[model samples]
Target: WAIGLLEVAFSRYCPITFGIRTMGLMGLAYAHYSFWPIWSIPIMVYAFLPQLALASGISIFPKISEPGFLLYLFLFLGAYGQDCLDFLLEGGTFRKWWNDQRIWLIRGLSCHLFGTLEYLLKSLGISAFGFNVTSKVVDDEQSKIYSQEMLDFGVPSPMFVTLAVAAIVNFFSFSFGFLQMICGSDDNEGLPLQMLLAGFIMLNCWPVYEAMVLRTDKGKMPTKVTIIAAFLAWTLYAAAFHISFSK
Candidate 1:
């Protein structure tokens, strides 16, 4: 039903049709059908690179979202909030002293310093750096970054430089991922890129792995025919990409 609804909603605005049309400007999407497996070979190769990041202390384990955990975060926050209320609205002298002591800590995390910084960074599309400097937008009246007047879509128009910068950032991102896939596993290994490829291969399997490992106890791999079909399809897609840009 969701797929039916999506088809109804986007039938006229078909993205794949549009995407293929865009690709036609350079070359047909299916121009190179054979080279995909070669490109995807590295996907498996780089799959282990993230392990290097973890061993080197630069990354952390993935946090798969679990149901009901958000309720826990909210409850924990509410309990803390209630404690704050008891220290504030409750009239005992000791309570008042305690509230004064904790006020700075609360103030620091509230819509104040660090929270504002976290919001700012997310807005800039700089999240790849792994820093949360700011969160939601501050009201114009309260924000000094923009004037009190002009506003559209709750965001400013995209700047040319912003697009260029995003492209550049994405280029480095692909380079880093590719580098990990091609590079050293050890002293005898050539480059570190294989690590990234291993990570990619794991990511490719992640949806099912996560489902069976965490979300469900049942474990099963699809039929061998299906697996081969998936690989061939993925490889063909990769081949197209590689062929289009191999020059």
Candidate 2:
């Protein structure tokens, strides 16, 4: 559904629709003609809910008006609840699984934000370095050290640069939005929802912020990466200011 929305939006923005259609055809071929397992009916229905809701400007059930909080509650239950169920099915206790899954909330945000940065970099002609497999065969001593300290970041990479930039951006965005709310600025009223959401997202990203700046362990961002990230962030802010104010 996300891909379909993107296709529709892009088609509306640009005159060229051939590429979008071709990509959609390729995806269908891979799913149906290739070895990929066809998605179950329930999975397809669940995936279409968000797009359907957006198109109809209502929840899945048309008879129910003003879904409001119930919409968000059901969305969360349909999504993350399945993961919780899976953990229980795998012989994991609910209490322990719930505690462990709390970290993934932050991780999901991190992955999406960094993934956006990666796409942005690619658009600017930067080639992505392929994925590296993390070693899972650590010794007992190494495991203990990692548990007490931080994950190893001995090698500097572009991924770290992206993460640092995102952390700094979230920090300042949340801080400024919070200050505006506290000051009771008129502008805050106009964008209260956005400001509150930014604050919530920043809270979710607290762990990334700690790893980027606060932690002084081997996993902490290197000085050079921090500098580059700060510079890129400043450049982006300056560009945004120019575009907004030049009008």
Give the runs in model 2 whose Cα sits over 4 Å from its true position. 1-142, 148-150
Winning model by lDDT: 2
Question: Which 10 consecutive residues of model 1 have the lowest summed lDDT?
Answer: 151-160
| Per-model TM against the reference | 0.20, 0.51
**Root-mean-square deviation per candidate:** 24.6, 11.2
Per-residue alpha-carbon lDDT of model 2 for 135-182, expressed as tens digits? 677776557657864444434766566556655665665566566567
C-alpha local distance difference test of each model:
0.35, 0.50
Clashes by residue pair, model 2: none
Tell me how far the alpha carbon of residue 33 in candidate 1 is from the true structure, in angstroms, after superposition: 37
Worst ten in a row by lDDT for model 2? 33-42
Question: Candidate 2 overall Cα lDDT vs. reference?
Answer: 0.50
After superposing candidate 1 on the true structure, give the runs of residues whose Cα lies further than 4 Å from its correct spot.
3-207, 210-218, 241-246
